[model samples]
Target: MEFGEKIKELRTTNQMTQEKFALRLNVTRQAVSNWENNRNLPDLEMLILISTIFHISLDELILGGSTVNNMTEKLIKDGSETRRAKFNMITTLIGALFLFLGAAFFFIKAHSVEYIDSSGILHENFYLLPTGFFFIFIGIIIFLTTGITFVNSYIKSRR
Candidate 1:
């Protein structure tokens, strides 16, 4: 049985209502409902309280049935992996965006020309080159760091 099912079973077996259980746990009735419905999980303290109140071992309360421990471990691991993947994707995208901006600035700087004003004075507007190079350097750093991190995480997950 799932954790939620186990909670519900214990509550019902002890002739306790959801409101009563929530009151004992110092939480809202909705919290109890959520737990029973598996919409959310209780934190460690609450889990301990549950086990204590129900007069059951923590292992029994959490495990509920065979393989539950394994399943929970797998779930946690998967969630972490998913978060890592998302981070990698976001970093890669931001790095690419920085690189594009840098390249665009560099292009503009290179194509810029010096022109004479109405006063017949020569003027140069080549300041963008330095800024472009700076951006390029920053972008490359971000790209390399994130890429390496992503590769490392991917390899780690494979094991």
Candidate 2:
């Protein structure tokens, strides 16, 4: 039987409704329905969870009644890698946004002008300058760390 069929059989044999199964998996009922209909395949984590909940081996859950091969491991690895790549991309983008905001603040601070008041007293708005520098420093650190992490992950994935 197919993976979806297997899942349906297991759910029915356990006397659980699709909604109940979805609740146990922390997913929506539609997601469970999709899985059962073979509209989509679950990620490695979800597959592992299903195996654990059903007391079945990953091999059986994934390969059904077929013999084990490198393809099964490859599928799991590819799914995991895709998830990691997406996470790294999001983190890098957030870090870049922080860096840009920090730079903009620093630029604004640099252009601030001092003025002489009616009493001939010089007034300079320097309070925000420190804040600007702090932001710039933090942004640089975050950008660097995130960039490094992305690069490292990329390199590891290539190998």
Off by over 4 Å in 2: 1-62, 66-69, 119-123
Model 2, residue pairs in steric clash: none
Candidate whose lDDT is highest: 1
Put down candidate 1 lDDT per residue, 48-108, tens digits, no spaces: 8999999999878877767655326645776797898888788888888888988999788
Cα lDDT, model 1, residue 53: 97
Model 2: per-residue Cα lDDT over 1-159, one tens digit each: 667788889899999999999999999999989878878778789989999999999888888886543436568678798897787777767767776776777777678888999999988767666776776677678768877887897798799
Predicted structure 2, TM vs. truth: 0.48
Off by over 4 Å in 1: 1-68, 118-122
How many Å off is the CA of 9 in candidate 1? 14
